[model samples]
Each structure stands twice: as C-alpha cells, then as structure tokens.
Target: MTAPASLRDHAYQTLKRRIVEVQLRPGARLVERDLAAELDVSRIPLREALRMLAAEGLVLLVPAKGALVATFSPADVRDLFDIREVLESLAARLAAERATPDTLAPLTHRMAEARTATVSGDLRRIAAANAAFHAEIIAMAANPLLSNVMGPLAARTEWLFRLTASRDPVEQCSEHEELYGHIASGAADEAATSAFAHIAAGRELSITLAEKWSDPDFDPELIARGRRRRRVES
Candidate 1:
C-alpha cells in the first residue's frame, strides 16, 4: 500500500509539471474539490501538494477562498532574471575553473542535443534542450548549495523559457557554443562574461512580453502558443 507521503508527493509532481508547462495557466483558479476528483486523490493529499506548490511561489492560497495559479508581472520577470544573472554567472565561472574533459562531457552533450533540437525546429524540444543545457552547466559547478538554491526556481525558469521561445534558437545555440568553448578552454573570466551576456539578452525579451501581458485585454493563452508559432514560422 502507498503511504500518505507517497500520494502527496505524486500529486505534487503532477501539479507542478502541469503548472510549469502552463497547462494550468497563470491566474487559473484551482478548485480543491474539482482537482481532488480529477487527480483521483483525497483532499488531504491534494491540499498537501498545493501547500508545497504555494511555498514554491507557483500557487496563491487565500484565507477564505481557495488557491489560484500564481501570476507573473514585469517586476517578477526582472527580479527573476536579476537573480539568474548572478547565480548562473557564478556557476559558469566555477564550471570553467574546475573544467576537465570528464566534468564537461554532459554539457558538451547537452549542447549537441540543443543543436539537434534546433535543427528539428520543434519549439518545445528546443526549449527543453535549452533548459537542459543550463541545468548541466549548473551541475558541472559541483556546488550543492548553489544547486539547492536554484532547484526551486526551475519551474519559473522553464516557464519564462517557453514564453521566450520565439527568440532565435540559432543565435541562442551559438551563444551556448561560445560559452561552452570558454568553459572547455578553462577561461573562467570569459565564461562568466559570456554567461552574463547571454542571460542579459534574454532578460530584455522576457521583460517586454511580461509588460505586454500586464494588459488585462491580453490573452494569457498566447503566452506559449503564439510565441511558439511565430518561431516556427520564422
């Protein structure tokens, strides 16, 4: 028999993935009764899962009302990128400083995977590959504290990556290649500079869309879908 903790964890991962993938769009109401029925879990475990998501800033719980999917704004995007710039740059520097063929293998593979996905021209695949590349870089840093700090922000980071999928994948992939060259060559300073520059370029685009999304008339559904279509067309 499954323990209560197991059920709760299962519900948490499912809900977290749905939210990150934007299947549960920003600002969507999460009715406990409906969610419990849909997930085929008891209200107790479902609520536990929601509380975990809430702690991660993916859900908002009201005192009297139920929960709602957390919404992002221009300020939020700015804040997120600001944190990322600092953290990711440090990771890149550490990765470069500690560079060895063995440590760099996964990043190399991730870059190759990203290039393949870019050539395939599937937006979702491209986004996933891009995220994996960054994750591999973080892992290469060999800093458990840094990884723990970044772990919670993964969902939000992926959501932003999806929103900005319209950006030129070729150019982004090229940037990653350059960063990889720096790390591979053990150029710590160059690696850090490259990482900061890459994130700074993406930051502007994210902030722009977030600003546009602030308009009440803007359709939230288009956040991922429309941008993705535009990329494919281009």
Candidate 2:
C-alpha cells in the first residue's frame, strides 16, 4: 500500500511531541517495530521520523541498536540554561518592544491558568499550562531566530522542571505570574531580569536534586554508545 502524504509528517510530529513532552524519557530505548505499530505507520516512514529527531538532538542513534531518547547531564542542563538565559533575555526585550494588547492577552490567560493548575494540584496540567505561558510570551518577540535558538534548550530543561512536581508549585506559579506582570506592564528590563532569575533558580534547584538523587547504577555502555554516536555524527 502506498503511504499517505501525511504519513511521515504525522509520525515525525507525533514522535517529536512525545519526546519534548517527556513521554519518551532520556535513555529509553525505542523499538522500531513497536513504534511503527504505535504510530500506525510503516517502518520506512518511522525511520525518517527518527532521523528528524536525531537532527534536533532529541533522540540519539546508536551504532547498531538504533535510536533512544537523549539524556541530560548536569553539565548539559547547565549549558542549556546558559544559552536560554541569553536567548530568552533577548526575546523578553523584543517582546516588550513589540507586545500589543492582542498578543499579551493570550499569554496572560495561560499564565493565570498555570497558577490555577498548580493550585488545583494537577501536575500534568500545570506543566502544560506553564509551558504554554512562557512559550507565548517568547513568541511575542516575533523573531524566528530567537525562538529557534531557545527551542532545544527549552526542550532539554523540561525534564528538570518535572522534578518541581515534588516541590513547591506555588513558588513556580508565583515566579511566572510576576514575570508575566512585568511583561504586560511593559517593564522590559524588569521582565527580563525576572525571567532570568526564575530560570536560574529552577536550574539551581534541579541541579541540586540531580546531584542528591542521581541514578546510582548508570549504564557505562550507554554513555559509550552515546559518545560513539556523537563522534559519528560529528
């Protein structure tokens, strides 16, 4: 049977969303046959979808065993946060300059939703709402380059933020609310600074937790496998 034109596109987006949403955890092996069946697509198109994720650094292609979700080291998370600080700082500044009532309204709604979701004790909804809030704010900058620069970093940081579910949600909700207030009020520098502080605080907390409760029995072979894939890709 000939594949539909949207077959590969659907697989690519489905896999990417799953990866970014952390449904596919880091170092989790992806079985091709299972993925094909799950996606209701042929293995041929699924392979292309995997390649797309590899290019974006969301999935790693092992030499023989094929692809798995990419893992984050503390070092990797730190590097990502550093990049995010720079890119998002610029985004905040531009968003301040470019923001309109129309644009900011959606962000405001999401921000409020985020706070309510946190209070309602719905971790998954809070996570989704939080992501939506920040994403819409960044989008106000209207610069493709800025969004492109921050996308992967944001994606990688999400797993760390998931740790927040176990901690205080009000703190996070408050942080975003304050940042959004600054953006809405056209306090450009204030918004940017607050954004940085928010991200930095999360980075610090996540780093500490990662150290305290790190995986005790990590797979050395997996690390080597990841390293070899990097070498080949390079």
Best by lDDT: 1
Backbone clashes (count) for model 1: 0
Report the error of model 1 at residue 97, Å: 0.6
Candidate 2 colliding pairs: none
Give the residue spans of candidate 1 off by over 4 A.
1-3, 215-234
| Strongest candidate by TM-score | 1
lDDT string for model 1 (117-220, tens) is 99999887888899899988999999999999998887788777776778999999999999999999999999999999999998888888887655555433
* Poorest stretch of ten by lDDT in candidate 1: 225-234
Q: Give lDDT tens digits, candidate 2, residues 1-234.
A: 445558888888887767666666666667776678777899878888777777777777777767777665566667777877777777777777677899887887888798789879987677677777767777888899878876655545554566445657788888887888788888889888988887777777666665554454656356534433221110
- Lowest summed lDDT across 10 adjacent residues in model 2 is found at 225-234
**Model 1 local distance difference test score:** 0.83
